[model samples]
Target: MKGRGQESFVSLPRFAARLYNALTHTQAIERQHREIARDLVARLARGRLLDIGTGPGRLLSLVHELNPELELFGLDISEAMVHLARKNLAGLNVNLQRGDIRSSGFPDDFFEMVTCTGSFYLWDGSEECLEEIFRILKRGHSAYLFETYQDFDESAVQKALKANLQQESLVRRLVTPRLLMSQLRMTYRTNEISDIIKRTAFADSYTLDPTSLGGPPAWLRIRSTKPAARA
Candidate 1:
């Protein structure tokens, strides 16, 4: 989903957001969210954390459960998503905002950790967004970007489908796998993503983790740190 211009800022509306909330409640998705939360909490056990494109807010919920002392924040381009996330995360101490990634409305050097999952591909002006991430993240902190990848072996795809979607409803079992596979074809390959990250300050301090999700080879993680070279 590489792109340029206004089309890059996509958001899910009320109905789509509701459907998304339901569809993503599978074991596979939950496992992915848990892994991401654990990795972030392990790296920065207690600090402000910002989750961009926080659809349904599942990841932040997990983070809070893992470490309730950490301050949590979430940003999404869709108002409906923000509302749904708020309802889902009711009683939790989280700050949810409606905004765009290219221009996150936060102070520079503000957050200890930043994360985006399954939504990085929809971003337009990705380099600009990366710069924003670098600017807001405190020096020596990190940002983890997780997205579906396109270069998995066919057997891996089949195994993932069986593990993640086999017990789903007939419609979901049939439609979800096909939808995911199609998007997989359209997503960034590891090298393409590497090239893009290479254009930003994170280039010097980033590493790719092919098995970050700890399940199928369906997702790729790009962990980038802001250098502590400057004060």
Candidate 2:
């Protein structure tokens, strides 16, 4: 968690890594990952994919299940998270590494698509991170970012709550709402996110997607592209 004026980047601690891994396994969280995976899988036929802040690497693992041929990579600032991602992604061809997004070590124009979910809010150097994303992403390709928003669509929240009430897991029904409320207070609004991206090289090349799933319509799914090379 990072405050508005925080100067330091915060990585989840080892203990928090364990707890987060467990929480992501719950039915509600799994559903969220699946929605993201399905969308990503449907968009591209084949290319390299990078998941920044790949906590526990569950989303990459789910993506792999749908499309085994796609080259998958996961990066996180937390060594514990990288270790857990490697463990969870075992037996799969996915690559997992520990690195910060402010200045990722990947080569320029490398990845076909990049994704960061639920992690963009914690970045203290968002502009730097977006610049790095632009640098590593191939021209004409896109990066998908999903972050929590403070002013989420109220009707969507009620719909999500109703869906959760029908779920069998007691924890999902009770704990998810509380978690959502806490995250809403800590995260950005769509306009704030828009402003940040506008300050980066990706300015004029991003759009917001309305379709998202998880706890509610609280997730802002922004797709930003590196402009294609002209002939």
Candidate 3:
């Protein structure tokens, strides 16, 4: 399962990358996630912000637009995705890199805010990745992780697909209910996600906010913070 999940991102073809960017542009759920992430970064982000698994860099671009003064960076495991993101974010005052989240190699207390969306479920070493995120984040700052649950709204997904693939019958046929369900199986439940957070450095310093994400019940956002040093 881990190998398959890793392959899904690492081997993303250029055509598939274009399709993903188009879907995010047209899909309602994807749009909402981007909007929420942008708003959160705009409000809470200061100094430097890093976005993990920033496929195509749409959310990072949005956040940069909202907070033009913010220093933004993006990392993705997929070289293809990073290429696409670099193209999408060209001349936007953003830094894009290709790397694994488990070993980001950034300095400690680096970013004021961090975010990961839609790709958290693909992480095979989630605990290590969370710990890496915790390490890079400045003390008292936060990282937000967004993922879809097993019971995520099927209707919205179908609607989003239909809206995005209106002219591509073959694409619509490929995105079947069975395929969606199978993909959902790769994701962790809300409690399971919380448990993963508890095992990380952010244990005892995180919030599982099911209501804050503002989408389907199965859509969850985990806000985890690194504590400030004792005085």
Best by TM-score: 1
Best by lDDT: 1
Per-residue CA lDDT of model 1 for 1-231, tens digit only, reads: 536322423545688778878877777778879988888888887889999989899999999999999999999888888989999999999999989889997999999999988777777888889999999999989998888887777797688777777667887777767767776776788888899999998888999878637456778788999989665
Candidate lDDT scores, in order, read: 0.84, 0.83, 0.76
Q: How far is candidate 1 from the true structure (C-alpha RMSD, Å)?
A: 2.3
Q: Which ranges of candidate 1 are over 4 A from the true structure? A: 1-11, 212-214
Query: Which residue ranges in model 3 land beyond 4 Å of their true spot?
Result: 1-4, 27-30, 151-182, 211-215
Candidate 3 per-residue C-alpha lDDT over 73-183 given as tens digits, one digit per residue, 9 for 90 to 100: 999999889999999998898989999988998998999888877788888788998989988999978887776776556677666555544554464446543444676
Give candidate 3's TM-score: 0.84
Positional deviation of residue 131's Cα in model 2 after best superposition, in angstroms: 0.6
Is 1 or 3 the stronger prediction by TM-score? Answer: 1
TM-scores vs. true structure, each candidate? 0.92, 0.90, 0.84
Candidate structures ordered by TM-score, highest first: 1, 2, 3
